[model samples]
Target: MQSSSKKETIDCFENAIKNLNNVRTLYTENFVNWKGVTKDSKEYYTEIIAEELINKINNENIISENIKPLERENYKVPSRGKTFISNTNRKEENVAKRIDKMECGELGHILYYQMPLKPNNKIKKVGKIDLVSFKKDENIVYVIELKVANKNETLLRAILEIITYYQQLNQTNFINSFKDDLGDKYKKVEIQPAVLLTCDCRAYEEVEQLDERPYLKELIKKLDVELFSLSLNIQSIE
Candidate 1:
């Protein structure tokens, strides 16, 4: 006869499998009837929903209590849309945190990640700067926008975002608030905007060409923002 603990473990596995089968059936039926939906869109939604269901099942307390832990292994979740798998694997926020630890000689003195910027009398935050560094020696402030992917669309959007941050920081009241945050060391600081890319993909070359466009070229010159790229290396250890 099966032991009580063994039976419970078997039951947990059965329930999880049953739930997954139900999810699959529902997904198939829904997709078949989903009119005007593109194939890629359908697949994206189905994969996301399936992953959510798996997560829910995996988190059940009953399963945790009854089943023994499985051996550790790497799992790759399906990518959605045009996103690169590497970006999701490493995570943009994680990369940004790592970058925050680097010394800033000309970059800045104090580095802040996800700094909130709100205009006067506004309750809602207008925007959150990805990274802000200050150089007390030169009285210069750097607003850095970090992106995991170097896609053209992503770079363009980041450019606009950093520009907005620079404009807001230039406001008289906003500058006063910034000075207060930085203390007396940075009494007068000039704002410099920048976009940092983690990957050296094809978009890097495209961004260079984009800089030559008359309107974009003028905007970059006027904002005095710099575009920089950094690469990350990873090795496996046995």
Candidate 2:
């Protein structure tokens, strides 16, 4: 929803976020009761809520020039390293950029550098997914992992992460933890796991080699993660 006034838009967004927090709290507290709530019911409720928020914001008619709805199916990834910044420790940010561009085209709404998958207050847990996108009301979002495609620590860790995200769909609590980041802008957002193996044939071969190792393959297969090999030439930095 577009708003004509910037002030109204910001206010509307803030109010929407507040409402979302309340709704999630209600859901969590009444999980057993709400368990019977069908997906369509949830979607309809959220859509109405979202529309109200948008109208509230638009009422002021002070539109922010920067606010724009994501376009669908014409996404492009920016030159890495330069345009996009990543935590030096992980390459997920860069990999996600590529996938978003590939899947959503330029019209994707990408949320990058998300808070660590495990919040600071929680018990020690592996970090967060690299990116999250709301692709203009599309059915799926790409949960990307960027790691070297060899028999290394990073690759193995990424595989685990992809599965974690996949399993997250079933964990209402864990998914709610992300509500702050996701906000209430999009409804029916579903994450699809993807691993962008950022390495050449040598490294790619290393992963393929794991095929013979039934255990490793089994673990990966369970997660239903995809593998995309990016050339080392795919500079993450500009």
Best by TM-score: 1
lDDT of 2: 0.43
For model 2, residues 1-238, the per-residue Cα lDDT tens digits are 2212434433444553454323212211211111111233332222232244345335632222212222122122234344455556344454555454343343255555332443234433334556555455554555665554333333334554555544433334433544555567334566667765655523355466664434444445544666666555445442
Candidate 1's clash total is 1
User: Tens-digit lDDT track for model 1 on 83-144?
Assistant: 22233454455555555636555665446565555433343334556776776667777778
Error of model 2, residue 124, in angstroms: 2.8
Q: Rate the local accuracy (lDDT) of all candidates.
A: 0.48, 0.43
Against the true structure, candidate 1 reaches a TM-score of 0.49
RMSD of each: 19.7, 19.4
**For residue 103, what is the lDDT in candidate 1?**
57
Clashing residue pairs, backbone N/CA/C < 3 A, model 1: 109-134
- Give the clash count for each candidate: 1, 19
Which regions of candidate 1 are displaced past 4 Å?
1-90, 119-125, 150-154, 170-184, 201-203, 210-212, 234-238
